[model samples]
Target: MSVTKDVAALAQPVIEGLNMDLIDTEYIKEGSKWVLRLYIDKDGGVGLDDCQLVSEALNDLLDGADIIKTPYTFEVSSPGLDRPLKTDKDFQRYKGDMVEVHLYAPINGSKLYTGTLHDRKDGMITIVCEEKEITFAEKDIAKINRAIIWN
Candidate 1:
């Protein structure tokens, strides 16, 4: 299993116990430094205290688990507004909200789409764009993120 998976598996229980959802896990390198980033969330949102709590707990757990041999920085954070919606819960939660969709290949001559999220069902996602509902197979989507509207 990958380090991100391993760490996430080991840390899930603790995150749930703390009443937070583990949004995503990323194990990446930046400027020759390895970083383990855990994105967490709750009903309203997550704060610094929540991040610190998970960090402290996971710090102890990861240290004892010895999952990574190299030096790494551990970080716990919120999956901010633009974070991708990867789960059914995410889709349901964001229903009726504006979202940006990127496809693996162009659909209707466009690789990118911005619309009101409608629903996700049986491996298909439906969105409302320009008052017309369009459905796409979930597999065709490269990513779906909560749209950041400046106005």
Candidate 2:
């Protein structure tokens, strides 16, 4: 398995024990440093204490496992306001919220769409855009994120 997946596997129990959802994990090299970022969340929101708690526990787990040979910075935090909708639970949780959808290919001459997330069922996602509901197969989506509305 990939380092990201390995680290995520190690971190999952620790995060869940504290009642937080492991939203995503990324292991990447930036400049001269390798970084392991863990996005976590729970009802209402996540706080610094929660991040620190997960970080400490996960650090111990990683150190004991020694799965990563290279030195890396570890970070645990919330998935912020414009987080990506990665799971069915996430789609359901954010139902009625505005979202920006990017498709793998253009749908009706457009590759991008912004609308209120209507529903996800039968392997399809429905979004209400411009007073009309547009349904797209989930496989056709490249990315779906909560829209960051200003004002």
Candidate 3:
């Protein structure tokens, strides 16, 4: 398995035990250094204490497992307000919220769309934009994320 997947598997229980969902895991190199980032979330939200707790526990588990050979910095944090909606559960949870969708190719001369996420069913997502309900196949989407409207 890939390093990210391996680390995610090892970290899943630790995060879940703390009553948080593991949003995602990424292992990437930055300036010749490897970084392992874990995105976690829960109802209401996540806080620094949650991140620190998960980080400490995962650090111990990863150190004991010796999963990665090279030196890497570990980080645990929230996915943030504009985080991508990656799974069905995420789509369901964010129903009725505004979202920004980027398509792999332009549809009707547009590659970007901002709308209210109406529903997700059978590999398709329905969004309401300008009083019209538009549906797009999940495969055609390059990215779909919550649109944070800043005041």
**lDDT per residue (tens digit) for residues 84-146 in model 1:** 999777887789999999999998799999999998999998999999998999899999999
Q: What is the C-alpha local distance difference test score of each model?
A: 0.92, 0.91, 0.92
Tens-digit lDDT track for model 3 on 1-151? 9998998899998888998889999999999899999999887789999999999888878998999998999999899999999977688778999999999999999999999999999989999999999999999999999998889
Using Cα atoms with residue i matched to residue i, what is each candidate's TM-score against the true structure?
0.93, 0.92, 0.93
lDDT of 2 by residue, 68-150 (tens): 89999989988999988998779878999999999999989999999999999998999999999999998999999999989
At residue 48, give the lDDT of candidate 2.
93
RMSD of each: 1.3, 1.4, 1.2
How does model 1 score by TM-score?
A: 0.93
Higher-ranked by TM-score: 2 or 3: 3
Worst 10 residues of 3 by lDDT: 86-95
For model 1, the superposed segments whose C-alpha errors exceed 4 Å read none
- Rank by TM-score (best first): 3, 1, 2
Once model 2 is optimally superposed onto the true structure by TM-score, how far is the C-alpha of residue 43 displaced, in angstroms? 2.1
